[model samples]
Each structure stands twice: as structure tokens, then as C-alpha cells.
Target: MNQRALFAAAAATVLSSALLNMAPAAAQDMGKDMGKEKCYGIAKAGQNDCANLSGSHSCAGQAKTDMSKDEWKYVAKGTCKQMSGLTADEAKMSMTKKM
Candidate 1:
């Protein structure tokens, strides 16, 4: 193959590899958006994004109570309170109440 053709092939291979390597990171970042915030008392039972503040479980989808006060879910930035979800302070209050 011509030198130009060889160089083009090599560049294409490199670019494809780079894009494959970036796919997972991009997906993870999308899941954990920089502009989003974790809103407590919003996730239904078995719907939390991850572990709970109370340490009742260490994984997602393990919440024992619907809308548990200590659990959190990622919500868009500045939309947590507007969604009727609890702020950190309100969540704390709920934590003190009987489940």
C-alpha cells in the first residue's frame, strides 16, 4: 500500500481504539452528571441509586422502605426541592421520625 494509505489506516485504528476506551468513562460520567445532585427521600423502595446514609444496605435497589429518608437518588441540579424531594435538612428530620 502507498505510504499515505498506510498512515490513514494507522490513524483510523488509533482513533477507533481511543473512542472505545472513552465509551465507558463517558457513560459513567453521564450517569453521575456533574450538574446533578443527590436528592434524599425521593427514591422509592428498591429504587435508590446506591448505598443509603443509614448503612442499612451497601448497594442499589436494596432500600427497605419506600422513600426512605436516608436514601438518595440523583436528580437534576436545583430540582431536588422542587420535586418535593427532601433537602439534607429535611431528610435529617425524617430520619428522626418512625418509619
Candidate 2:
């Protein structure tokens, strides 16, 4: 390839990789939303849900809150880790678990 063509290809490759890296962060944000919503539903019953959510690529830790006084006093929040090989199904399962 000519110098100009080669440079263009390199730029494209870099941009593609950057976007790929960002995708996991986006997906994790979505998963966190899912987990937080589920946490709300379970919070009333005072249950701790610790499902691994990051598609097995990364395991996002659960947010810890003190539930000493009342169930509503504490809440769990989850955020997906930014990484590759994570699937939607895995994220869903991580967010929604029977407690």
C-alpha cells in the first residue's frame, strides 16, 4: 500500500480499537442499571444479591450499604466492568438473581 493508504488504514484500526474498548464501559453501565433496579425490588425483603455481572470477563463488585436499622436504609448498586467477551445474557443473569 502507498504511504497515504497505509496511514489511513492505521488510523482506522486505531479508531476501531478505541470504540471497542469503550463498548464494555457502555454495556457495564447498562448492566449497573439492571442490577440497581433489581436491588430495589429485593431491598424490601432485606436480601443481599451477589451475582457476578461482567460476562465473566470482569466481575463488578456490589455496592455495600449498611442495613442495620431497616431494609430501606440500605441499597445495592452494580456496574459492569469494561472488558471484552461479555454477553448480554451473562449481564442479565448477574443482575437478576433469586434471593
Candidate 3:
């Protein structure tokens, strides 16, 4: 292979190796949520943890407004109320009342 082609292949291998190493750490971070609970009405714009209570979006980080009742984030268990956030059911009910 030419020097340029060899350099490109080496760079690709290094980048892929680095990304593979990161996968385990990312999964470990997700595992930290085992004891967490969903806290609604606390996620800032584009910071939601997963699908929202509303059917508008089906993915995380799609919230358009801060403290939206439909958006949620994972907080330590039993702290949702302390954080001025609501439970899933409460958020759903609140959304219902606004309609």
C-alpha cells in the first residue's frame, strides 16, 4: 500500500479500538441507574432520559422545553418530590388536565 493508504488504515484501526474500549464504560454508566427512579417535569430542554410521557417523541434528549411535565430524567429513588418533580402517573395526570 502507498504511505497515505497505510496511514489511513492505521488511523482507522486506532479509532475503532478506542471506541471499542469506550463501550464497556458506557454500559457501566447505564448500570448505575439500577436504583434510580424516573422524575418528571425536571428535565431541561434536550436533556430527557428516554421517551416522554407525551407521544410526540419516542427518544431521549428530545425535550423542547425545560421542566416540561412530559419529560423526565432518572433521579435517585425517593427524591422526585424533593426535587419538585413528579412521578410518571402524576405527570400523565397533569398532562391530561391541561387538555
Give the top-scoring candidate (lDDT): 3
Task: Give model 3's TM-score versus the native structure.
Answer: 0.67
Q: What is the lDDT of candidate 3?
A: 0.83
- TM-score for all predictions? 0.59, 0.36, 0.67
Whole-model lDDT for model 1 versus the true structure? 0.77
Which TM-score value belongs to model 2?
A: 0.36
Q: Report the poorest 10 consecutive residues by lDDT, candidate 3.
A: 23-32
Whole-model Cα lDDT per candidate? 0.77, 0.39, 0.83
lDDT, model 1, position 38:
75
lDDT of 1 by residue, 13-50 (tens): 99988876665345335546577777898889888777
Model 2 worst lDDT run, 10 consecutive residues: 66-75
Task: Sort all candidates by TM-score, best to worst.
Answer: 3, 1, 2
Tens digits of per-residue lDDT for model 2 on 3-51? 9999999999999888766754564466456544322222222232333
Which residue runs does candidate 2 get wrong by more than 4 Å?
Answer: 34-99
Model 3 per-residue lDDT tens digits across residues 1-99:
899999999999999888766653454366266888889999999988777878787566689999999998888888899999998899999999999
lDDT of 2 at 54: 28
Root-mean-square deviation per candidate: 10.1, 14.4, 6.0
